[model samples]
Target: MKDLFDYCDFGDLKLNSRIVRTGLWESQREKSGNMTPDIYNRYENIAASGVGLIITELYSLYPRDTFSKYSNTIHYTQFVREARDLTDLVHVYDVPIFAQLGFVQYNKKTQQNMKIEDVTIDDIRKIQTDMIIAAQKFDFGGFDGIQLGLGNYYFLSRFINPNFNTRDDKYGGNTFNRLRIVLEMIKVIKDNTKLHINCRLNAFDGTTNGMTLTETIEIAKLLEKYGADFLQITLPRSPQFFTRENKEENPLIEATEQIIDNVNIPVILGGGANSQNQINEMLNSTNIDFISMQRPFVKDPSFLVDWQIKGNGESFCKTCNNCYWKKTATCHLRSCNP
Candidate 1:
């Protein structure tokens, strides 16, 4: 029988266990996009917490693309040195880390905002180049892998969604056309670096005419064909989507099974996973090879330690989503803070 503590092979990367620490936005970077001591300590704690893989917080590849209101962007080469320092600390525990790369063209604060549809062919080429440059930096920084974030309604997801992409060119029309940018980026990274590639993809957007589960399954297969070694299934944040009522088994798990059936690569399922029982059940029932959590780690950096000590216990995280609103990534819950 397979267990959560069993060793798992994700492509060429070998994880110590099946627990993966998914990327959580930590606005702990310096003004110049450099790593801070707080960020280093946070990762160090997580590394020592017994999680198998650590996926770093979302990082923007371009200066104009701002994913969060508080976080800094890695637009300069100097920032890569700071990233290297963090990776080095995480490696000290012998845990592999992957950088989550994403971009957002428009934010309320930026003076010049551009949408996905506004991007021309030249702009697409430039974006792809920027992604390659970022991936190269990650490779140089000693990261085990690079996760291309094609979810969370970011730059890549916007281009994949039919509702957001209205272009008539080869870059946007059918599913193949929509995935062209992602495929090209994968090719560039595979050709230029030895870094393993993981893709965080949207299974559903939870809206009418948005990217549906069926389409995302096909996209998952295409991603595998294009060189993605691992696929992390995620969904857009919708109040009506993947509600807590069905905590025992959510639609994301079912969607992940569907994708797993089509691809040979390892699949990581995220969302609504709060306890050891939930993770074990998902892993046992579905073809998912691993499970990931973000909020639980924020609530308690030693979450994996607690899980190891106790066979199965619910995490203390209330899933309040307050960390997103705070100036920095912090849990306001007294239990988490005290």
Candidate 2:
């Protein structure tokens, strides 16, 4: 029988549990984008807390991108060295960590926030090249994988959405063409590095003429066929979209199940779950073997430890969205201890 705490095989990597910790913001870092003591300590606590897989907070691809101020950036000189140390520390606890890399806007020096249709082929090549370089740095830092931010209204998400990408060029017409930009980048990243490519994709964007579940299923299949080792199912605005009103039959869960049916690789049901019994129930009820949580871990990095010990446990997170709105790593509520 499937269990949440069971040791499992997530692709080639073995995990301690089915709970994947997906991170978002990083407000604890130094102003210069350097890792601080609090950042390392938070990670150590999370690593030691028995999460199956740890996806680190966003490492913005561009310093000027929308969420870069609230995220980690590899442009700093100490990035490789500090990342190596951080990966080493997580390795001590036998937990595999993947760096979350993404950017919200594509801005060149002269052009500020270029639209998807406005970007030229040279601009596309530049984005691909930048991503490849970032993957190499992650390889040097000893990361096990790289989670590409292709979901939650990120620049790439917008680039692929039919509503936003109205370009008449080769990079923007059919489903494959719209996805070509990411597929091409993934190919190069795969060829150059050993990093496992995990793409965070939206199940449906709820926008008129935007991405629907059917199109998303096609995208998942293409990603698996091309190179992605794993996928995370999300929405355009996951945090806001996931409400506590109906936990029994979440549309995301159903959407995720549909996505899982189409793809051969592991697909994570990202966000909205906050309890162990609920997680175990979902695991037993569906074919979803992996589930990812973000805000709960922010509320308490070591919360899983307590969940493991107590057998039946629930997170203290209020789902207030402060972590999302405030852009901080630590919870804004009361002090948290596991």
Candidate 3:
């Protein structure tokens, strides 16, 4: 039996355990997109809590990107310095940290979302340049890796989703075309820096004509071929379908198995995984390399340590989804539960 505490090698990333603390949006940054004391404390607690790896909240690459409103933007020198401090703090606990990079183009004046079809080849190249610059800073800041967030309804995933991408240009139509930008960004980051590059891809959005399991599997293989260190499987936030109770195995896990079978790289899978039994069962049943969790860690930063002491017990997170609304990524029900 493979214990969750067992160490695993994710390319150049050497994890102390198989439990990964995936990224969760935490509205704890300053107005200048620099890390505040609150954000620092949150990451410090997580590092001390015994997670094998820590993937930071989304960091916007472009100044006009929609994510600029909520998450940190890495285009500024102050943000880079803060990120370096964060990496230093997390390293004190021997936890490798990865910055989650995502993009969302908005009009420079109106600040509204731009249409995907209107994005010209020049615009795509500029976006790629911005991403590479941000990644270079991350590498200089001492981050262990960069997780390209092409999932979670972000701008990158929006371009890949057939439902949103309706252009007749080279970046549209076929799966390969839609994936062209991401593939290019992966190559650019690899050429520019020595940081480990991981991709967080969406398997399904639970909508008609959205990214399907088959397409995601094919993309996973392509990402491996393009030099991605690993693939983290994720799903879009579709509450109506995925949140409903089902006795069968989680769809994300099933899709992850398909991708794992087809790829030679490590696969990280997680969605609504709140119990140690469920995590261990999936790890033992499937060939998934690691199990990731976001909400559970939000509800309890020390959840992994608690699980270790309790011997594979259930997590304390109730999956209330309140943290999503608060934009603080904290458990609002902690007082009531305690």
Best-fitting candidate, scored by lDDT: 2
lDDT of 1 by residue, 17-126 (tens): 88888765767777767777888888999998788899987776655555554654566567777778888898888789998888767433444556667776877888
lDDT of each: 0.80, 0.91, 0.79
Q: What local lDDT score does residue 293 receive in model 2, on the 0 to 100 scale?
A: 96
lDDT of 2 by residue, 59-89 (tens): 9999889888999989989989999999999
Q: Report the lDDT tens digits of candidate 3 across residue range 205-275.
A: 87788888888888888889988998888877632223426455577878888888999988888666777
| Candidate maximizing TM-score | 2
TM-score of candidate 2 relative to the true fold:
0.97
Query: What is candidate 2's local distance difference test score?
Result: 0.91
- TM-score per prediction, in order, is 0.92, 0.97, 0.92
Candidate 3 ranges beyond 4 A from true positions: 108-111, 238-248
